[model samples]
Each structure stands twice: as C-alpha cells, then as structure tokens.
Target: MKDFFVSLLFFGLTGYFIYLIVQNMPQLFTETTTIKQYGLLVYRLIMVFVLFNLGIVSSKNYKRSKPA
Candidate 1:
C-alpha cells in the first residue's frame, strides 16, 4: 500500500509538470525577445528536481526493504 501511494504521488507530480510545460508552450516558444525563457528554464529545473528526488527516495526504500 505504501508503495502504491508513493507511485501514485510520483505519477501525479510528473503529470502536473508535463501539463505545465505543454500549457506554456506558446509563451515558451513564441516570445523570442521576451523574458519568458527564464520561466521555461525554471520549470525544467523543477521537473529535474522532482524526478531526481523521486528516484532517490524509491531507491532508498528499496534498499532498506531488501533482505540481506
């Protein structure tokens, strides 16, 4: 059950991140002279952080739960 919930949360966060990127496609691509580039960079950085943290946590839990 714990693993199920954790996976669900991870997927939810990832889906939300994708949604944000897709929704901002216009501002991220259309504004060649605007400052929206910074926002896109920040969003990508956040997605990387989320994916990294999820991997770290899942691995830690797997290691702890494994039998010697």
Candidate 2:
C-alpha cells in the first residue's frame, strides 16, 4: 500500500511538471507563434506517451504486502 501510494505521488508530480514546463515554454524559448504552437503540441504528445510508460513501470513494480 505504501509503495503504491508513493508511485501515485510521483505520477502526479510528473504530470504537474509537464504542465509547468509547457506553460513556461514561451519564456524558455523564443519562436514565431505558429512554430511555438506546433512545438508545444509535439511536446505534449511526447510527454503524455512518457506518462503512459511510467504507469506501466509502476504497475509492474507494485507488490502486495503479505500479512506479518
């Protein structure tokens, strides 16, 4: 149960970090409006895919604790 919760916390943080990165992208890099929009779209898609992989890893790692 503890391990499961810890993984859930990390998953949430990963998503929030992705959001923060996308929102502050304009300050990080300067580009034309059209290019910037396309770049963000690509970045979001990639990050979402990465999140899916994290889910897979978390699922594989979770083990039910046996009673003492």
Per-residue lDDT of 37 in model 2: 66
TM-score of each model, paired residue for residue: 0.54, 0.50
Query: Global lDDT of each model?
Result: 0.68, 0.67
RMSD (Å) of each candidate, 1 decimal: 3.5, 5.2
lDDT of 2 by residue, 1-68 (tens): 66576668667866875786778677654554577666876777677777757765765567535344
> Which candidate gets the maximum lDDT versus the true structure?
1
For candidate 2, what's the RMSD? 5.2
Candidate 1: segments with Cα more than 4 A from true spot: 52-68
Per-residue lDDT of 1-53 in model 1, one digit per residue for the tens? 46545756776777777777677667654547366676676876698578657
TM-score for candidate 2: 0.50
Candidate 2 deviant stretches above 4 angstroms: 6-33, 64-68
Error of 1 at 28 (Å): 1.9
